[model samples]
Target: MKSTMANLWHLVKGVQIRDLGEKRYLFKFFHIIDMERVINGAPWTFNNHLLILHKLKGGEDPL
Candidate 1:
């Protein structure tokens, strides 16, 4: 999933994907522009499964 998303975004600064349990994931972007681009292009999907995105605050649990 990580590799696939990284390829799809093609972010210059790259991103990190970490499993957050219960089918959730944390997408950590290395650059603000990269993050904004992704958020702006919302409603991303994988294998026909809808992906829900949420911007997390510092020290917040993404569950």
Candidate 2:
């Protein structure tokens, strides 16, 4: 999970880790992906999909 956060920190800005009590930390990261090429409502690309997976794995925030 640490590695995922690290990668996100490197790729995006405004990444934060928040303490939500009960020994829990929340990681938040934002990315802007263009979806003009989508035929239906699928607004995600392969890269974005991978990024979401990485974030969910509990990576450390580099920031």
Best candidate according to lDDT:
1
lDDT tens digits by residue: candidate 2, 1-63 = 445644533544444556556645554554432111121223323434422222343465533
- Listed per candidate, the RMSD to the true structure in angstroms reads 1.1, 11.0
lDDT tens digits by residue: candidate 1, 1-63: 988988998898999888878988889899999999999998899989998888888898777
Evaluated at residue 14, the lDDT of candidate 2 is 40
Question: Clashing residue pairs in candidate 2, if any?
Answer: 1-58, 1-59, 2-59, 2-60, 5-59
Instruction: Report the Cα lDDT for residue 35, model 2.
Output: 18
How many steric overlaps does candidate 2 have? 5
Error of 2 at 26 (Å): 1.1
- The local lDDT score (0 to 100) that residue 63 gets in candidate 2 is 32
